[model samples]
Target: MAEERTESKTTILIVDDSEINRDVLKEIFKDDYTILEADNGKAAIDMVVKSRAFLAAILLDINMPEMDGFAVLTEIGKVKLLDKIPVIMITSDTSAETERRCYEQGVADVICKPFEPLIVKQKVSRSIELILSKRHLEEQITSQTKLLRAQYQQLQKQQEILKKNNALIVEKICTIVEFRNLESGYHLRRIHDFVSILGRYIMNMYPEYGLTQYQVDVMADASAMHDIGKITVPDTILLKPGRLTRDEFEVMKSHTTRGCDIIRMLSDIQDKDYFEYSYDICRHHHEKYDGNGYPDGLKGEDISIAAQLTGLADVYDALISERVYKAAYSMDKAFGMIVNGECGVFNPKLINCFRQAKLEMNNAFLKTKMKEKEELKALHGEDDDYDDD
Candidate 1:
């Protein structure tokens, strides 16, 4: 009963030219609603415009003086109040055309006169119930939409943090390898650039490879880990200035598999795609296309594309850079050696991409070399002006 009285605070507007008809409706709804009265359509429109937010329903009469109910409905619609407040036509006109007009004007229902008070009350009550229910559902949907957007934003932030952590781990590992190999820090940078140049050329020139720019970038970054296993090799074998004996060479070859082991231990911390690319490049970068290289002689396309791309880049960098056992070959000689298969058999498709990327790769290496020289000069306190050549 208390709840019922609380709900009765809702307003109902009664519009009719006849005082008796308005009185009848006011009596029927008086117990359950706060009623407002207007004896004509113009007066009703003025009240509705002022009190639309407080109204639950409107009872309107069709045959009225000065203005008809239809004109009032049109005015109410222009202000967009019909949807928010239910309106039921209360009229003596029982003609089908009059009823149709009331409906077309967006009245909730038509109650014919002399009307049954119970039926009029029931129809108006149902319309108000439906409108209230719809509003409640709209509110719920809006709240849920906001929650989902917030959750998606949180997920994106977490993913970015994970990516940064993974990059930091890679950097630390590369730094360790640089110090152990007695190679300049720029060696890793050159390898990264070489892999990128070849990978992008392959992606653009051969649609069959199905490589996206994102995948190519991942492959280039993973190339840094290709020789990470060399960290496990003994300094006697790794830093030897003469040719390796057969037994020492076998131990050196083990670095490929050992590098994969190191990457596997980090699986928990690495992104799935990055881990897979790193593992493949570490384990199979030495495998030749003709199945004649070590440690696992994976042949042809059996080798992962990431490994193949990194393998080519690694060999190119190794040939052009001085190592413990050999002098650095000139760029022209190194390019010829790979094309002629003097080093090992390589994929014809990759060789073609290599040829296409040669100029860009050369430029990238020289750029890195110049940068390293400038840094060394700066460290030695040399003047800024230096020869471009």
Candidate 2:
């Protein structure tokens, strides 16, 4: 028994109005526990608050001078220390109503004043064990909760890192395709910028697309790979100075499926949004809204929205760009051709957004022209004969 008391080092608080009752209880438990005595409820509350970390149980009396047992329980409840310390009610009254009130006030057990010494010790020991067990369980739950939260945050950070890396790899791969197709890197930049603008407008005006901001961002960047497969086309056809023959056009169209296959080889891209947007734009950017597109005649909404945004961006750039087959059309003519359906059918909703976004598009074009002039002036000196064409 002495060894057992030493192992646990239990502490007990006895609150009572009578010095005799306090003395009796202390005498009973003094051998087995570190006993704390309080003459009134206020003193007991103070003791419980001060020693809450070590105190195992509280022995409270129902009748006291200023604050009663119920009032003390209320005070303990205010500090939320009731569960940490098991309360046992000790009083002279043995009425059922009084016992019920004590139990309702969250006491561990109620004992009449003519209590047996052995019974008091047994009850207090059991209550102390119960409180200790509850505190142990609560501590375990708090520890586990903290651990899970940390793991979740770590997982989120790792996923974000992977996404950023995949995007960089895609951009680099697209740069290689630009070189192989004999186009400047500016083509990729302009396509990405144009599609981003269209995607933002569509997300704001069309709720049916269910497009999230993350999806929009991925789609914009993924558009850079729309011509990744043009790297596979023969130089004779890819660099043709005139319109392609029917056979040559057919060969050129195969780039769509070829680009998809090439993107699939990149095993590092694990994000579903990135993969889906990249694959869809690469394979279906040439698809028409009227189901007359090649490789697969997916019409209207059947073609992924990602493809639609990228396709329009491609068409706009190709019109304004001086390709081997044609001189650059003026901006007004290109806009008229797209809006008048000369550039194949397009989604009506996107068509409206295209109209609204044209002003911004022109502004971006002017900025590029200004940057080009700056570069030219740096190369040829500011006073050199410079043509604005």
Candidate 3:
């Protein structure tokens, strides 16, 4: 009475080579479920594909004339559309290798022949639940994939507009920040170059970090504004000839927070990856993993990864190159200091990555410098030629 109550609740497809076996099972499970019968694996697959109702579970017999269940499984596996359905292999073989192979082939369960009606009932119940779960997950992935592809297409269409606006926004901020030491704030250019270098390394090493060629370009473009908050600080503090007074230093430290906030207020940063990049450059750039840094004083992994990495790039550029108040150090000097753990300013993880991609990063730095020179010349109306050069 209970079995009849149960099979009535689920859709079951039973495959067997023997007509007698099919009759016996049908009689046993008749009251419990809506049962569909097939004489072999081929018929079971055909029934599954054509049925309007979704399959709750499949009982596949391994031994049969014409097509064995194993062969049917191989064919079923090849059909991508039907891959989510769970198949319970019904066979008397009981060998360890056979059992292992069934699991490796994605079979949900194995049932020995001369099966007790109760065991059949129990296995079917479990496998049906599993199959339904698998189908639900597959449906979720399919829906998500569709959503992603649509979003990607929309983004591609708006990409050119995004790039132009983003550039203009960053340029304005850059101009504001560097107006005092504008002659030397070329460090802004180098910082973008450094971000691209690290971005490429992260892409090659861990593509899962949301790194892409487009993202690299975006990082290079957005990184220009990392120091934009400095514009809000007083000229007295920014252009001071020596170390900042503690009060002045506090005001200076506010730049990181200020930069992030400024970027946040812009509509352009509302798009994809903007907040991620901004969050990194803004909040945690001054944080130390060991908890001794500035702004948030965040330590360890609590630091936003984007901020931590940008911190490393920012410090390296500061250490290696000329500033309004300092001369350029040789690459060897800067690199040695970086590797030796200078103060607590940098993320060691990023420093290690710098070593691995050192040659590439330096090359990118030179390219960025050249690009900056070109921009400067263009701004001054320096080049005139064959109307094209």
The superposed Cα distance between candidate 3 and the true structure at residue 66, in angstroms, equals 27
- lDDT tens digits, residue span 1-389, model 1: 95455345988899999988988888999888988899998999989987787789999888898899888899999998888888999888889999998888888888988869899889999999988988888889999999999999998898778678767877888789868863635687788899889989999999899999989988888888888898999999989999999999999999999999999999999888889999989999999999997887789999988898888888888899888789999999999999999989999999999999999999998898888777667755666566433
Q: Across residues 1-389, which tens digit of lDDT does each residue of candidate 2 receive?
A: 95445336778888998999989888888877788889998888888877777787889998898899999999998888877888999888989999898888788888787979888888888887887788789999999999999999998898788778777876687668656753445667778888888999999999889988878888988888888888889999999998899999999999999989988886455476677788889999999999998679999899999999999999998898778788999999999999999999999999999999998887776676576567657868878897656
The numbered model that scores best in lDDT is 1
Residue-level lDDT tens digits of model 3 in 1-389: 85454444766778998888788777767887777889977787788776425566678888898898888788778874335666888888989998998888888888887878888878877877776778789899999999999999998879867767677776776676657566435777777778777877777876556667887777777677677788788888887768788999999999888877787788445555665676567666788878998787888878865666677778777776656457667766877777777746555656667789778767766676677667767866765542312
- Displacement of residue 177 (Cα, Å) in model 2 is 3.4
By TM-score, the best candidate is 2
Which of 1 and 3 is the better model by TM-score?
1
For each candidate, how many residue pairs have backbone atoms clashing (under 3 Å)?
0, 0, 8
Q: Select the stronger candidate by lDDT from 1 and 3.
A: 1
| Alpha-carbon RMSD to native, per candidate | 5.6, 5.0, 9.0
Ranking by lDDT: 1, 2, 3
**What TM-score, to 2 decimals, does candidate 3 have?**
0.56
Off by over 4 Å in 2: 1-12, 18-37, 57-62, 69-83, 86-145, 181-184, 269-272, 330-332, 368-388
